[model samples]
Target: MRARLPDIAPAGSPATAPRTFLRAALAIAVLLAACSGEPDPATTPARDPDASAEGQAGPIISIRSDPETSAVPAWRAPDVPVDAGNLAQRKQEAAAALEADELFGEADDAIPLYLALREHAPADADVATGLERALGAVLQHGDAALAAIDDDRAALRRAQEIAAVAREVAPEREAVVEYLARVERADAAQQANRSGERALNARKIVVAGGKGAVAHFREALRLRPGDARAMQGLAAAESALIRQAELAANQDDYAAAEDWLAKAAKVRPDMDTAADARERIARQRASRVGNLRDLGLAALTREDLDAARRHLATLLRIAPAGDPAAVELRRQIELASHYGLFRPGQAFTEALDRGGRGPEMVVIPHGAFRMGAADDEADARDSERPSRNIRFDRGLAVSRNEITVGEFRRFVTATGYEARATRRGHSTVYDERSGSLVRRSGVDWRSDYAGKPAGDQLPVVHVSAQDAAAYAEWLSEQTGHEYRLPSEAEFEYMLRAGSQSRFPWGDGAPPAGAGNFTGALDESPGGRHWRNAFKGYGDDAWGPARVGSYSANAYRLHDLAGNVSEWVADCWHDSYRRAPVDGQAWINPGCADKVVRGGSWASSPEQTRSAWRLGSDRDTTNARVGFRVVRQI
Candidate 1:
């Protein structure tokens, strides 16, 4: 006799039916042991032939009540009946069904015909050979059907029918038991898939206590590892979680939205879907926070401080910590209450009441920096000794470039103010022909470095410190903002552009695009070059280029360290004695000389150092001196 194979129980089903076990034990003790009939042609007969009566009810789950046998499945009969006539006729009919390839199913199959004759003629050669052929054929069909079910779930029903016939023919056979197991697994996976769909439709994605679409999908994966249908259900569940995150973000509940995204990532760690969803949610959150920031800024602009505070508080709760927009809005609230509202690095032009705009200015954030060079610095001067820290608590705005000819022309034309050079009728200009700076009678604000009519775009070089202040005063009157030269400390800070290096660029040779410094390669109109200039460095011009001829520094202030040395508001001091630490201009009654900061086109490499400073007479005007304005905000 063939050793019996164990039965497969459904998940959560009892390992054995206790009540059925006791009843079966009593029946076995009362019944007499029967003799085996025509044994299987090639193997032992499957299940007791008498069990067919129980099979008439339907295909039932085999009970594993007896451990020794471990199997009992009396399957339902095939749908189509074969002839139950004389032995020869039955054999002929079974042969015909086999020829038709109807092995075991609803159609007229040979397995059913052989089964009908097996009871009475178990010893016959034809029945034995015919029965063995039918059993093997039916087992092959069940194998193919089970394999098909994995790819096409619709084939599951056919697989189940094949399993039923295999059970009726030989439930205890090893091949039959394996086929049944495959079908059951497919069935369990399908059920799991259905449960996931139902949970998803009910919006039970990622519920607490492991009971939702996530749970159901996980169960499906356990039932059939790597099943395509199970994987698809998981993807759907993950999508549901992502959608929830997106919705939460839209509602401005960013905390909850992040939680949803994290859960989605857990569900599908192998996929980029969760990562993409995270970015999408973050963008939505940014949009929502941005909206709040705009509302806060608008309210602040309208002078509604209370409303602006409320909006800012709401934005802070939703936006990530240290959000730039939220910080800007907060700055606006504070600045609007006292001074003008502006963001650092923000560029704008002041609108004059006279129906024109002032020079383009970039907002500067207030901070503290060391004002002078360290003691070990190369070529450090006594004027830059004893470096002191300077702090500007209030934000200010500085013109992006030196006031151009056209810009100063507007002030002069509007105010009819005569600059000191124009009044004197004599100002110093660079003599390119002689490679010298000479005082020319016609040199003034309208003159270029060579004492010619300057282009509107080029910086006006022949303006004195007094002239710049006069223009700043006129600008203040026109725009209703306090416009003046940057303080000595502020000018140094702007020139450094947040650097402590030897030069504004760095300690090394000026890289390409480091601005219009004195370069050995520089050629004047007369082919003149500096004897003590940076080798291999040239901007191809001997005179100052247009106001913004070079790239701006980190502060977006152009030409702060190149083109020309600009004047500051602070009076000239011999050294660092009693200097102002608050970034205010160190002025005294009747001061004659003012502080100048930055490198000029004729300056040597050491002179371009950020720490370099020059003190000039208040009435000084030259081809290499220009000025930009600063506005108090």
Candidate 2:
């Protein structure tokens, strides 16, 4: 094979070299065919590897053997150093492209291109114009998107995206900032509206109406003014409250009905239901007034004064004060109370005594007391022994004051009756010369203890028991009432009042000016007979000063202690062994000595005790004796 290769060589070349050359030629042909499918490496533009790595697009390459016959794929150049003219031309082309497609929100496509162009051509007007136009297009598209979408969250997201682009592109655009704020407010308003709707649906019906719904609706209106749905919800809530009020009223729950009605009125005062409810309530109250009036009248007819008063008061509260029935009921109640039966502390004047011009009389309540005196009483007489318990079965009226000289004179003048003392022309009087009491002729009921003229206000002393009885009988006839002297028990009871002491005032010495007892007054010129006056006691009066010369007892009767001795209905008894337990007068058919009670100015302190008693001849008269009258009701 080596000898055959040497014969193929025409020159003096080696045969192995020819074979190597042919092998190299074959490799070149394979390489040329591989490159023929792609553009020629020498004719193709080179790409900067650093520019490509920096997020820049690959450079646009153009290779053409015939300019009109070949087409090149469109491409974006990698970001690179460029002249001002070329950068300007590129920015204008980009802006024109954005204008054509309106891909204004395509920041990644357009914004970076303009910024890269601006880096190369910092003062290029076309670059500046393109950048501004791109930002404007972005904001305008955002506004359009916000307007297109009905959802607030969607609009807000779109607006935020646009705002981000604008901030990077043109951060000083006032309209973009304003549009963002508007979107935020719109979002808040929409959120509030949703919350308000939920609250309105979730509200509970209560006595105070739908307060929750009202608050929510109001807030909704604040965020979104004049919201028709919120207004409608509020109206519905008010209507619901009014309906609740109506139901309560139908059930006769007037208080609850009123509460609901008030709530409705607060929401809408012009609701017709509230007005209608008020009218119905008025009718119901009017009917109740009628029922109450009937009850009051029935009670009055039954003589239940307290129950009648209660019902009538209720009626007045329900009915108007000017109602005729209420006025008449009040009048009836007053009339009944005025004519009621005798009770303790009740006071009235005799109608027959010149039409309520008679002496005032107080009703004494029926009670029991230990009559007479204790056995250890210092000055108690034998007639006051064996203190008995006497009870008054019925209340009686007694004169508030003793029979005055003026009152007795009226009885005498009307009846032309002569008193026993006047007929006798002699009475017991105080004789200053002898400093003792003595019988003085010409001294009668009209004379004082010293034989001086007595005033009409002073008590009519020197009256015998028979005279006192005669006067009481005359007054009874004049007044058409039963009047008589108090029983011995009644006399002592009235004198003691509620006291259990020696004196009504207390067991101590009588206070100065307590009553007209035998005191310093007797030391006066015409009062020398009171030499045994109680020590440390003075009333400034020798004898009776007036009918009420002393303070009254608890029963409000005056001069019951020491102004004068009083005549009682009982005949003189030695002891309480046979005393009447019913407080009636104890009298024997033939007993001529009547009982006298209470002490006079001429008596000592011991004699002035409540239980002290004395016996007096029925026809005998004395200056120190007087009487009070009692009447049966």
Candidate 3:
């Protein structure tokens, strides 16, 4: 069920470029957060154990697209007080402890002490008060920082929606900025662990980190000023328009406020926050005498007396001058005297109710990339002949890495899923030195490789399409969500992540860290390197390497192009000419040939192309063929 290919790094492989390393490092940074600070036991939030991976909180992500619970009023929790003397004493004690290698308790303990000081300190206090205040802010509202991330993620989804609507319109920057900034921010936030001030630095990197995320967004508009993502980002920055509207309203600049709010509403009408802003604009407009008359007339025409009454009450707030319309304004005011102002915050109260985890899935953005073989790419086969352009939809969640052996085992134990190759079948285990294949004895999911002990983080191999499907179904049932083999399109979309290059990484073979390829193994000695290519006895170890044993793709998806061939949901189609344009698995009622993707560890370079497509019977199984599951959005 679980298998590991050997790691054989080649000697003197080129060192990875620093910029690329930083970029890759930023993308995977989230997973590293847990290991940074000591887990705090003093202030623990009640976390749901059955929470989905996307929604789980462990110093990183806290909210999902839909929160399972309603939002609690930002309640003020109980606080303990401390005097200036005690505070100073504690700081000195903490400094001494840090000198003695006891920082574990500092970040965790310092938070509460600082929070108490903030609650009781003078408003104008400086120096020590300021320092403790900042530290407390980081600790006490760490959740807010976490929630800001949630908002940033929400803004991304909103941007995608607008992009869909404006597909035909000129570019919008607000949406683009939010979308790019989010990916860069989350990626940096996730990786800020290597350095001591990473969390603080994460905020700074959002100011431009990954591969010029901010720069590309800006330049796209420069190149084709109407590009969507770029315009979206600009729109996001100008979001201050809404705040300006509120300021106008406070200054009784009703007309200007209305104009500004109307623009805000039109810009992103579907967003929840925008709706709230619109309600405020309505209330502000109602307070004007002339506006009240207009509202009353409009309400009367619609026969909504309650709305007319509310408008009139607001009209009387500032008495109108002695003009001809004064009598009418008073009449409207009297009629609307009992009316109440629209409540802005009510809509979001249950908003959290509708919330659980936002998407509970990561969004792998869309783009075009080559998906086939390359020169010097070994293991050429008929199915992998030509590379082609593969376009993916804007947002999809590819597994952050290959489904680890440990994760796979959890599925097997829970569903009792069986591997078909392990069931009354045989597979050829290639011998690198002899250049010969030996039919390995005995097979079945549970019985094959019984004596071999390998890591649970390795890929699960020897699985048929049916086996993969069954496992997916089992996972779905257990999780109360749909889980199944990714459709051929979905698999390609994920493998490509956001790039259109030949491999999951880019136009050419990825650098050694990008994957566990033959060249990579030839570069490293002593330590294990994923034997990506077959050069002879020493080139490839001829086995599945650990999942994520090598480098990850642009989206941090591991083993996407190699390590093992994965089963996809669709039946075999020689060409994508008639493939589904909407990114679904192409299923035919009578089709018996299943699609398999990503070359296996045994496969040479040529087989790993993005467009390489292979067909196998539904019942066929082999050590090289495995699977990764996908959740429909």
Candidate 4:
């Protein structure tokens, strides 16, 4: 019961959507002081992370996206102060240390000794002046170390050690606090530069969450805006995006090219380079379009409509608005399925809108042909009298074979439509036990001639005319094209396929291995052979074979004359009194019966004639009947 064809491709969803993120922690923090009068350099409102010079304090990014986590060390954990005893002796010792130029190394150094004297004498200007000179020397060493961070990482570590000593001797000095923060920022900037270079070398150009080369390079700039290496890395990232844009433009995907260029603008923020790329794309677009048009037209000439359609899709994406060349190419491709471009007997298929494709079809040429049997034709019925000259001005395509179980299963599954036999729970099937046709229970479109489960390649039977029309309608919707049961006249003409003989072969008897018809040598599954049939022909088939099992007709159609009788669009009439002049369906609204054409394996010699016809109830379902469709160009 769950017999759906596995032709459709499964749908998919995006794995990850790109998004924006606000950097946190050590990613460039800037704090400003009160917007009042101009503040002096000591109270210069130090930013949280950056420093213009190693001697000054500012705010900037760090090694990580987080603001608080970085390579910059913390303010030296609270150091012990110099011992403040023996005030006069301490001052004299401090003076001697300063004169000897032993700044602040040991306990008896100039700055430490001065700090001990200051604690005893609150208004000691001499101690304060000596401490300032010692502080100046510390700053000179720290500033020089900060500048050397890019060349020598050990220098940055040395700068931090010196700043810690200055803070310990001159605890309340603003210059010491600023100098320490500047050194930390320079260290963070160096780490960011190194990280960016690693990512760039591995080709991690752009990541969604600020982990790629572009993000690292930008962070380095935020920490130290003048870093030459970081600046160069960022430029390289922008250039990569531009190269991608050019590649997409070459493939005729202008929308994707523009998308790449937009990303480049965000990375580099330059207008002129982006504009130049756009101009180059525009100049190349005309030539690309010309090449596509030429290739598409050539494909049309060769009847490679699929390749032609592909080129047309590319033209739609890259061509300028309302371009005449694009419009003309579209028209030419649309008209390719005609007499001028398409040859008779050429096979093709149409792509469905959702997935897969319609049944294989053979193009039929446009010409006038005799529709019905003549008066002198032997064994011709009254219904075939007064044969008229029917003309087909428009080229048409017919299914190469009868609709198979696999093809019909797709229609029933897509629409959840039940066939008439399934609704009735019974259909006429061949009873092998009695060697005769009998109504069987639970037999529907899924069963074969003997009421067994059918193979997918076997022609679908036990379906009413209404069910066949429903399948055709579903095909039309899936393919975005018109498809319906062929007209009775058209069916007969294709069955003959340039043959004027009684049968599709010639006047007398069928050729060897002609078709699946009633033959004297044919045997049924029950070991019974045909009682009345061709003298010595045996097609080796007791029931319907897989579609396209035998040789094709003159028009490259399979199983037309002998396989199964097929439903057509026309309603049954007694004679050709008021038949349609054009090869269109003849219908009386709410008619009781539908026209059936072609012969079956159980047919006698007369029944196997190309001019054979049958009129069955519209809702009748049987194993001996199937259908084929016609597609309009």
Per-candidate TM-score against the hidden true structure: 0.59, 0.47, 0.39, 0.48
Q: Write the per-residue lDDT of candidate 1 for residues 602-631, one digit (tens) a residue.
A: 888888888888888999999998999999
Cα lDDT computed for each candidate against the true fold: 0.73, 0.64, 0.47, 0.73
Off by over 4 Å in 2: 1-340, 351-356, 520-522, 526-529
Worst 10 residues of 2 by lDDT: 24-33
Off by over 4 Å in 3: 1-361, 366-394, 431-435, 446-453, 506-509, 520-542
Model 1 residue 21 lDDT score = 23
Tally clashing residue pairs in candidate 1.
Answer: 0
Question: Candidate 2 on 1-633: residue-level lDDT in tens?
Answer: 111000122222322322111221110011111223322333433222111111212111111221111222222323544465676566655676555533332333455567677778778787778777766666665565445333222333444445555666555678767766655554455445444444433333222332454565556566556644445545654554554444454444556557776765665455575577667766876676767666765665567879878988777765665976676567556555433365455577775554335567887655668877777767777777888888766667888887888878777776788888789888888777887779999888888877787889888888999889998887787788899999998998888886777787888778866788887445667535455667777787776778776777767788788888889989987788867788899989988999989887777887899998888799878778899899997
Per model, state how many residue pairs clash.
Answer: 0, 0, 65, 13
Query: For model 4, what is the alpha-carbon lDDT of residue 291?
Result: 82
Best prediction by TM-score: 1
Worst 10 residues of 1 by lDDT: 25-34
Best by lDDT: 1
* Alpha carbon lDDT at 10, candidate 4: 19
